[model samples]
Target: MFFRKTVPVALLAASVFAISTPMALAAGKGEMFMGQFTTEHGTTSHPMGDVHARLNPTTHELTYSIHWSGLTGDVNAAHFHGPAAADQEAGVLVPIDGPYTSPLKGKVQLDSQQAAELEAGQVYVNLHTQAYPNGEARAQLIKH
Candidate 1:
């Protein structure tokens, strides 16, 4: 009787583990990426800004929040520029449409290539202002 019960319980536990392992693997873990914007990182001079973002690997969804103060002038645009290093420049990969105000928050769906670049730490955030059309502040997004 002891042997019979032990064998069945062990088999049940093994079955459950096998079933759940794939589900957990498929769900994956959420990845975090963050950056701090500074005039030193950009082509022109301006005040500081910050960005925090999360990427859901399973869904390919990216959610972000940004805050800034003391810019040279009003912000006109912002973007995630990528496939480049912190010291390098690249065309915009994702444009941040906005009322151009502070404490910006939004979400976007990233393609596989964009997601891969972001995970590889080749992406950066940029905020553009009237005083600095190229970009007022910039920061490289580092994965955490």
Candidate 2:
């Protein structure tokens, strides 16, 4: 029901987490994901960015990093929106706080439903800016 990516970063993190977090190791290997953000996918053409995320199935922990560039205005907000197909839009599933600057890093523990949706590649990361109050850039989550 879960697909694990044996990327070096994931493997290395898994080893480290294994030492202090046996449950994480026992839960299983982490799944790696990538998202390429662009204005074309959003409601308007005003910003662009990239997002990286890892999900530890056993722990329900979602670790993420986002890099944004070419923003037309200040980043007003960002979130992990979900359960939508590539061509559709959906409600917010997780709120992402900042270091509003580039290379944002954080983690959130997901609920069972969210975890399932993530594993099924139904979630996405969206960056919003003042110019595009709705959304400036968006990237659909997909297992890497």
Candidate 3:
């Protein structure tokens, strides 16, 4: 009887501690942001897609998923361009891994500045193709 009671109490204490630990140790979790990619939104008009991304400030990781279609030709490259406002242009900030195909999923480790840019809605994902070397489809990342 004593062993049974002590075991149950210890387990209950352990369970309670585990549950509360995460909350107390929680870091600054960021928000999930999304964007609709389209040709008109880009510098050209040929490709379209959607982008979903989130920046985890605690880990300094940016996770992204993209689905694209209607690309004029084979995808040549894709990247996250940054520090540009909507309808404006900027340089590439992060190069996405290629053989670029639809429903792409990837993660990138971002620095403090990049995380700040992402939170500020200054980052955009752009897809480049044979026809449009600049950008075929683009979308501005916005915090939701």
Give the winner by lDDT: 1 or 3. 1
Which wins on lDDT, candidate 2 or candidate 3? 3
Predicted candidate 3: what Cα RMSD to the true structure?
3.4
Clashing pairs in 1: none
Native-to-model Cα distance after best TM-score fit, residue 44 in candidate 2, in Å: 5.7
lDDT of each: 0.86, 0.83, 0.84
Q: Which whole-number lDDT from 0 to 100 does residue 81 have in model 2?
A: 88
Q: Note the clash tally of each candidate.
A: 0, 0, 0
> Which residue pairs show backbone clashes in model 3?
none
Q: What is the TM-score of each candidate against the true structure?
A: 0.77, 0.76, 0.81
lDDT of 1 by residue, 51-125 (tens): 899998878788999999878888899998989998889999999879878899998888999999999999988
What is the Å distance of residue 100 in model 1 from its true position? 1.7
Better of 1 and 2 by lDDT: 1
| Candidate 2 structure quality by residue, lDDT tens digits, 1-144 | 133555766788888877968766566678998888867434535456788998988788999999888877777799998999777788999999875788889998899899999888899888887778778788888998
Error of 1 at 138 (Å): 0.3
Whole-model lDDT, model 3: 0.84
